[model samples]
Target: MNKQELIDAVAASTGESKASTGEGEGEALDAILEAVTSAVTRGEAVQLIAFGSFSTGACSERTGRNPSTGETITIPAAKTVKFTAGNSFKDAVNAA
Candidate 1:
């Protein structure tokens, strides 16, 4: 689901209003997201038990062929976010 949908779901689950969750200032869900994003952007890892972990990863620069023109192109190195699901999350998905 999208951001609004997620916010709605969390608000519902916590018996809070949508405005309280993320629509207004000092929103709880938004704060949580911001914390996670800030941590990841700093090359730090964020791990939530029974959910997953988010960490930074890297990709080396390399040469690749362009599918359209079949011409060689240089791909620059970049940082990436990685997520590894915990056992509980994996079990839930598998069960579903």
Candidate 2:
């Protein structure tokens, strides 16, 4: 679901007002994003129990073909983000 839907669901479940739920959710998401960016910038990992982990990794420079031109070019190495699903989440999905 999108942000509004999420806010509505949260408000409904918690008996909170939509504005308050939205504000809290937004602040929480912003904090999470900020923390992840900060950690990744430092080449570190962020883990959330029963959800997943976010980590930084490096990509090796490689040659790749351009689909339109069929010409090969170098792709520079860069940092990458990774997410690994938690067992609980995997199990829930599988059960579904």
Candidate 3:
């Protein structure tokens, strides 16, 4: 589901209100997301016990071919975000 749908579901599940400004499910989700983002951006892992962990990984510089021209090119190294689902999450998905 998209963000709005998520916000609605969260609100419904928690018996909270959805407001554009103060004390709402949307704001709470946004805050939680922002915290996770900030921590990951700082190269720290954010782990939620039954959900998953968000961490950073790296891709080394490598040679790649341009699809259209088939020309060899050097792909620069980059940082990447990685998510590993927890066992509970995996179990839920498997059950589903």
- Measure candidate 1: CA RMSD: 0.9
Off by over 4 Å in 3: 20-26
Candidate of highest TM-score: 1
TM-score each candidate. Answer: 0.94, 0.79, 0.92
* Cα error of candidate 3 at position 93, Å: 0.2
How many clashes (backbone N, Cα, C below 3 Å) per candidate?
0, 0, 0
Candidates sorted on TM-score, descending: 1, 3, 2
Residue by residue across 1-96, what tens digits does model 3's lDDT show? 988888777778777776642245557778888999999999999999999999999999999999999999999999999999999999999999
Runs in model 2 deviating more than 4 A are 24-26
Question: Residue 46 of model 2: what lDDT?
Answer: 85
- The TM-score between candidate 3 and the true structure equals 0.92
lDDT for model 1, please: 0.95
Q: Could you tell me which residue pairs clash in candidate 1?
A: none
| lDDT scores of the candidates, listed in order | 0.95, 0.82, 0.88
